[model samples]
Target chain A: MDTTVVNTGAEEKTWGGGNKPLNASYGKMMMWFFIVSDALTFSGFLAAYGFSRFKFIDYWPIADEVFTHVPFVHGNYPMIYVAFMTFILIMSSVTMVLAVDAGHHMNKAKVTLYMFLTIIGGLIFVGSQAWEWATFIKGDFGAVETRGGNILQFVDAEGKRVALSDFVVAGEHERVEHESKNGLWFVDEGTLPTYTMQEVITGFESHPDLAIRTQTINEQGHKTVLSREESIKQLKANGIGIVEGANLRHNEYGTPLFADFFFFITGFHGFHVFSGVVINIIIFFNVILGTYERRGSYEMVEKVGLYWHFVDLVWVFVFTFFYLV
Target chain B: MAHAHKLEILRGLIKFKSNTQKIWGVLILLSIITAVEVVLGIYKPESLMAHVLGMKALNWIFIILTIVKAYYITWDFMHMRDEKASLRRMVVWTAIFLIAYLLFILLQEGDYIESVYSSGFVKKDF
Candidate 1:
């Protein structure tokens, strides 16, 4: 059929370094493409979070109250702590960009300096997040009496969240006890707590002075809150631990859905920050080793730079929704 | 489009001043806004407590401001606005569809859960 055709270089190879469509290196282009996909993934997770939040609109637990712990401080502080964490992540991103600039100019010392700062910033941010998570898991004074398996909290005489034990006199009934796992749930030796829930209920029934009043219910039929005296009396009368999710009733905090979304969205974003830090470290090492300088291209640093910036980008959204909204 | 004065813009953006200045400025602004939001979240301002449009006024403010800030970070700080229109459209369309879908489904399900909660268990007491 005589279908043989001779190559004449008529159309140049549209890729490779010369005569390229974008005129950028493969590595940089790949990084950009990856960033686009990653951004979408994050957005999806965040949007899902938003949907759940909007669904539980009226009764979502307050974020500030829930996240009220800071590192190196013991007392109850509000969202001030997380606000600080957000700033740290954003600052680290700036440092990463500067390090990339240094790499572009073949300044190893400057690159190292900026990279070290960025790493420190990332570490601090991660540590802070861990501390916040620990506080959340342990929980504060749980709900003493719950309307919907949700916790009910009250301020004590000192206007502080008081444990159920604090109000009751010491020599009441025994507290809850658990058997050891060694035995079919071990009856391993341990002291039982004072004042069982039944005992507290009986105490309240017998003692008018110790009549309990819940945050939900007051002396009157109206939903009036109690004073410290009434609060103590109520706890003394009907001793019980904070709401501990007896059976799917709503707790003091918003729906369990709120907590679920909190862990998922923030957990995902934290993972991104963790990986972003690792990637930056790899780029930092390469810059120090003169990898890009030898190849006459610092695009490696730039690629990592884009990833770092994206992490910051995602955090801005996370901070807004999780912390503010 | 080619940069007619790219070098000038880059140089004029800052001289002796470092990039840290811009970073700090934006960061401080963000922090201030956060502080304001935190205050609102904690106190649940009485004015906001008064029901408006079937929700607390504070919630309305928080959601609105949060979206605005997110736009700034995405468009300006992240330089998404500087990208090709196709890239921007790809991101915008995906976000619009996915976010709206998620909201619709989850919210419907959540409201259903709330109904189950209110009706099934805690009804007699109230």
Candidate 2:
């Protein structure tokens, strides 16, 4: 009968709970733990990217030059679209927080609406990322790859970039298509670049105002621009072929590793956003069904909110590391 | 500790009436920081381009602003501000220490490789 006596101590009361650890729900605590591990994984990728960037410090591609294109626009607008993407993601994170707040208030309708907006934002971000990938793969100004595996770009006397189509003159040459009927059926030519090395060289020889821009970043943090004489000499001596856009083996931007890291990092992040959208849709339906209303708490929304916010946080770093720096 | 929320951000400089208001406040802060970053990146002022610790001064600004944004997103949007101290420390400290260590090792190796290319026998251009 005396066992009902008052008892209070840190050790006895601390580990007594089965669900709440440190006063946080088990799900929330687990989500935070998972996020820490995932953050390390992302940082590892980004750090390796940094290592490669530093290794090729002088010859690394200028991110502004590479990511200049905006969707449905023809002119050169550097970093504008990526900036828009970042804003959209941040807005989504805001909406996600709103949903979680509404959950705390037990407002099912508000939570549903905010969740819908967050889903829309996620979709837009994923789509924008896809468009960016396509634009990067289909490059702006084509460049020539040297025998030493270097990228050599073309520029006008004013230092504006010149596309291959602007200068490469077409020559009349009868060529057989590399079809399965002509060549080995098992292996066919993997599409040819618009212009050959000879055509580019010949075009360079004709254009007096054109010069070559090496991938090497000069003292002013711009690509090194060579004179007409040096351009012609370099092209004739080392130019092997033309690289139209980015691929695993070659990239018109600069080093192939640049394209490689860009693809891997952004692709991974896009995949996360894609899955986040899918999860949001599921949670949206659950909220519409009033599942949490019956359970008397909206802890599920809080859990997913953690994930969405984590995605946004990672993008903040990615945006800084890749685009700005 | 029991009933009231620990959600007020900015070290109590600007306390929010509700979590929704706090979310909007964070959004505005993040947007302003992003705007500053984009402007600095686009203009790349000559003074900010001066090298500092093997990186541009402007770049250092970007990284710092990025960390600030990350903090707001975590503390406010993710509700980490309301989290218990143990949980917060467990997540934040682990990430910070590990990422710092990783960056140190990887960057040092990268510098070594660069030295090899410049002063050592290895040549980059064939």
Candidate No. with top TM-score = 2
Q: Give the per-residue lDDT digits (tens) of candidate 1, residues A142-237.
A: 455533433345443344555445454435444345546545563555434344555444433443333222434222212334654665555554
TM-score of each: 0.72, 0.94
- The 0-to-1 C-alpha lDDT of every candidate, in the order given, reads 0.61, 0.90
Error of 2 at A322 (Å): 0.3
User: Which tens-of-lDDT digit does each residue in B10-37 have in candidate 2?
Assistant: 7889888866777788888899999999
lDDT of 2: 0.90
> Across residues A1-325, which tens digit of lDDT does each residue of candidate 2 receive?
7777354444456565453668887788889889999999999999999999888888999999999888888998888999999999999999998898888889999999999999999999999999999989988899999988999999999999999999998676556667877778888666767888899998998989999999999988999999888899999999998998898899999999999999999999999999999999999999999999999899899899999999999999999999999
Clashing pairs in model 2, backbone N/Cα/C closer than 3 A: none
Per-candidate interface C-alpha RMSD?
A: 4.7, 2.0
Of the candidates shown, which would achieve the greatest lDDT relative to the real structure? 2
TM-score, candidate number 1: 0.72
